[model samples]
Target: MVQLSLPLKWVALAVYFGTMSTSVLAFPQYQSLAGLSERELKEALPKLTPRLPTPPPRPEVYQGAKLVDDAAHPWRAPRAGDQRGPCPGLNTLANHGYLPRDGVASPAQIIAASMAGFNMDLQGASIATYVGHLLDGNLVTDLVSIGGKTPKTGPDPPGNGLVSGIRTHGTFEGDASITRGDDYFGDNFNFNQQLFDQLKDYMNRYGNGYYNLTVAREIRYQRIKQSIATNPTFELVGHRHFTAFGEAVFSTNMWVDGRVKGPLENHVTQEAAEAFFKNMRYPRGFFRASKPGSATNDQLQFVLGTDSSRPGHFPGKNVNGTNSFTIDHSQGSVADFCAFYTYFVGTRIKNLYPNPTGVLRRNLIINIEYFYGSRPPGIECTKVYPYGQL
Candidate 1:
């Protein structure tokens, strides 16, 4: 082996050092890994509005109004003479008697120690659906009599036992319309008498006995009678009333409102129900329509329609993934409820929440026929005059 001298070894080491330095200098520039660009956000967000704090989720109990329970709603079959006594929904509260049977309430126990229950449901439904329920459930069935086996007939033939054919449209021009009658059963006062009787029944069942029940009943009847005389028939068909007991199905399609060629006020005519269903093609899948000015995820929906062929239609998709059609109580009209509640409580809510200038003040009413039908079991408008087919 040839021995390398110390001087050569030193030179070789220097050469090695130079190669390492040169290799390091040839490395690529220090670039960062890909990242979100500042411009990306600027281009993405269109505009920023001051986010208003969402109103606290509806309270469990506002005054005496009860919050609607999703689970309990479908089970709330109306308990008229068929079932008799207080409804299961009300029975839940009555079992304890609106307040605790055992202990003190009010200052010490303001909140219900038990489940907060109202004689009528207050918060669960949309203003429209509730109104529909009120008209179909309360006014036509409970309020009116139309006594005798001589079935209430129109120009059209009466078909099946299923609830069908609502007189949603048409003016209250003649004696035939519910507007003219005072009682639902019997020829006497027509719907008017039935209305009084039902009011009496509500007082007996739900009233706290704050005032003379009979006198109060007379006062309430007068208000309804006057309302029918003054306003359009639709006004009598209060929106909240329909939603309360009527078979309602709502869709989440935000565009549904915008699709209207005319203003929304005009759009909610008698034909509106038919028009809305006609347009949607009866969507079956889970769809979401946001309430106006809500966040993207704040989607809403309702059942498409009810099968009046039976008292309870099979629950279906409500634009949301949840089953849509659900009803346990006979729909009660907000107008009637308002009248009833006010008579009991001794004042109206509108008196408390008055509207200011330019803004319209709304007195809640039921769009009864809109939900199911204004007619009896055999001849409901829902049966003959359906949304799309009609």
Candidate 2:
């Protein structure tokens, strides 16, 4: 759907010499604040921050477990032409008609649908949606295929890789996925029964039948070990390092019956988990979280942590051969968003965009701020501006 492309409003300032880079940049109507005049950006110092995209208004109170996939939003199996992906969360959204069932969606549609359908927090939804859009979406069309590369997403942006959907390895999706295989194994999006079995096993052993923080960490640690032992190209660096934990938290929390408890309560039964992960359907009468929620920096630390003595605790790569990983202490961990942001924009984005100007450059500036500003409270990370100011 070409829904979010609003016409850019051009304005002239006599004092400013340079023309406003003829960048025909576009964002959702709610995000008009992010696309500022360079002069305005310069004038407004630390205050010129991107506002979180707010979803449609809702009832004040928590409406416990109702039919989320009701008559209005029914679940349907994906047809042959439909796209599905590594993230079961988005897949479920599409399956339930919260997103376009065809699998192509704009960042705004994704953000709104995700929040309205699941009560996802603005920060959490914005970060995930824009990351997918910026890295894997077609900026010209403002479309992202939730699954594999498809012409339905429209042509690739001039030189920014293939614009090959979220399933592209190491972009937004990466290794140690609880229910999916690494791209090295050939199919990264398809559900991996073997890995799911391991996940269930961890819940049985650690969480006593619930997927809590303890089960989350144990399963996460075990999965990394499995990948290191088996896969030839096992790399957990950059965004994957933190996103790995965020995904774990999503699984551990997303499908739970909200009537039971709180914002980030960890009590997802295997049945609820199985329903979402495998069937792409909610457990009947499912209610979303009492409040919008997701993992915080402290929560992420607890979920990603393991015994320091373990073999695969630190990030590394196999320079010599399989299993011959050299510890990459320089890559840093989820605890440090500053380093992650710096590395992500400075190195990662720069590779995709060797020299971005015009609309692309301005969009990059907006997206990264969405990422860092959402960092959990008490996480003292100074923002990194790789694209220079506005």
Candidate 3:
């Protein structure tokens, strides 16, 4: 277990597993949905936690390769009302109707689509969806725009509150993206051809015509270096440190056709990369990954390996001058898995809904639990309930 700076108190217990074995000291067991609440706090909260949406079933038979962009699922440009964002995977799914063409989807819909379209494992997709939805989405309606903020995600809160959708920078979307530019340099949602070209350059030199973990590590650092030199507000602290690398690894892992397996497991080719990054189209007869996959800790290690140059926990923002970074790992660091969790739930989520109550509060806690269970590489930390149990 992670030795959090503070001791684990009695407000809430770690609730990741399905069943609890034995408890020690004041700590208690939080099992399933039924155990989350004493009584339905509101009609919205059937239990203290909402039931997670079941992912779409994988086909029983693997017929050569199942075409995700098949006749039934045709690629179409997003209409004016439909949303698109930094996540090209979601955008491609929407283009082919794997998800709703409108781009506004519930956590359940998102989990289902990610599974069916990209074969992203339910755990991986849940980790992404809950964090994205809770922070940038509408908790009341359980809807989030895959692109820029839209009124479709229900009414807004008073004051500085923002239901800004997935495009809201500093939440899940952050700097050093594989295909998108930093939000500090303006429009971060749409594909930036310049940034993508840089990715191709690194891929040519590193992967020799393919996008893999090696290329991802180099390109990720290069992109960050670009941001630090160009954008004065470049910051890679907190969850952004994780995303900085995770996003690139995700592209390499998920973008390549799962049909091309064995020796070429995680290799994404040029023709295929262009289809996803530049055009948001699946290559001809594109098939979902042979199985569910995501940027797990093992995959992410490629980015945070023993390379002395790579910033592990020493992620920081440019102080003032170009390339003048002031390293700070105060909140957390990518090198420490539990430290990442401490920063994510304790800092980010806590700050977002400090005074949440009723349905709003209940959902936040449940979603936080989902994030806790996402389990990055060496996550052994106890869940932090920033807002103590009411």
Candidate 4:
């Protein structure tokens, strides 16, 4: 509301007029500097085009289902303590010469014996694939009985342990990458060495000095560490252990043809079979596909031979034999779930954990392993090995 003198008003008017004149000349001057005429300037500007988002590519589908072997492949020599002999579970079978007596109980030997029993061809197959089939396809049972005590109490609560400190038996195939950093397991819980020692003992006693379950377990654990360093999504939480602490995995069986004349025929029910695997636990190990072009890496699959060809599948011996195997908790003394947890899931990580700081992490891992073990098998077992007495 202040009044200004006439001279000041005239000065203000001159400034306003100068500014307008400059703005009007600005575009023309810019055009001149750019060496473009008005028409050219308009034409030089880029045309606006509507952009559309691109659709994501579909996931790769694996198709190789045929099993093949490579005759040129050389057999790997067994490590020390791989000599085969008698074990607690199958002394009767070994004494009878049903299973081979010379080979070590290592992964390769186990594959050879299992393939021979199943009538699968493994002449040229990669020994790795053979191990995968034997581990994934077979059902391990403990003929030992638990003295009226449950080994496991319940699923591990989240934030308490990685995957709830529980484990399942079988292989889960997927594109495992190291970049993921095994963060899928949440807290980092190193596998316990003491548990491995116990596993070694299991090998000496049950494996007859031929197979060292602990060594095999450690090898797989190392492989997983390497895999995590290389792959992006794959991370190992824990592995399946046959001997939950000192308790035996009891009765180990494979999915044989239900029609095959064997001692395991007509023993398992669909309900019980489903229930057992619903909470199945497995030890850690590296597995590869015998056949290529398939989802042979991460997804879990459980299989067995059944009595009849259920539907469209071929009428071969039931891969899911009705009574392929049983864990006669009633036979010998079996350990309870708590002991099983201690050895399989808890011990490996718990014992090796950095006390206090890793305690929660170890618990978390145990929980997660248990969670997966309680679920049905999702990955199908592929035949990639041959059968031979070990």
- Highest-scoring model, TM-score: 3
Q: Candidate 2 overall Cα lDDT vs. reference? A: 0.67
Best by lDDT: 3
Compute each candidate's TM-score over C-alphas.
Answer: 0.18, 0.77, 0.79, 0.19
**Candidate 4: Cα lDDT at 14:** 96
| Candidate 3 segments whose C-alpha is farther than 4 A from its true place | 1-65, 150-163, 311-313
RMSD of each: 30.8, 11.1, 15.0, 27.7
Q: Mind giving the per-residue lDDT tens digits that candidate 1 earns over 1-390? A: 887799998899999887766543321111100121334223212221212111112334333322322233322222331111111122222223342221111210211222233212222322222222222111211111111112223211122211211112211111122112322222321224443344345334433321122323333334333433433321222222322122111211221232234334111222222222222111122111212211011111122122334312221111222222233223223323333322211222223222211101111122212223222123222122111121
Better of 1 and 4 by TM-score: 4
Q: What clash pairs does model 3 have? A: none
Candidate 3 lDDT tens digits, 216-328: 88887788777878888788886678666777778766787876868777899999999999888899888888776778777777677776665433678888866777787
Task: Tell me the whole-model lDDT of each prediction, alpha carbons only.
Answer: 0.24, 0.67, 0.69, 0.25
Error of 3 at 307 (Å): 2.3
By TM-score, highest first, what's the ranking? 3, 2, 4, 1
lDDT of 2 by residue, 248-310 (tens): 887654577767765436688988889887788778878876667667666677876756766
Name the 10 consecutive residues with the lowest summed lDDT in model 4: 139-148
Tell me the deviation in Å of residue 89 in model 1: 1.6
Clashes of each: 62, 0, 0, 94
Query: What lDDT score goes with residue 375 in model 4?
Result: 21
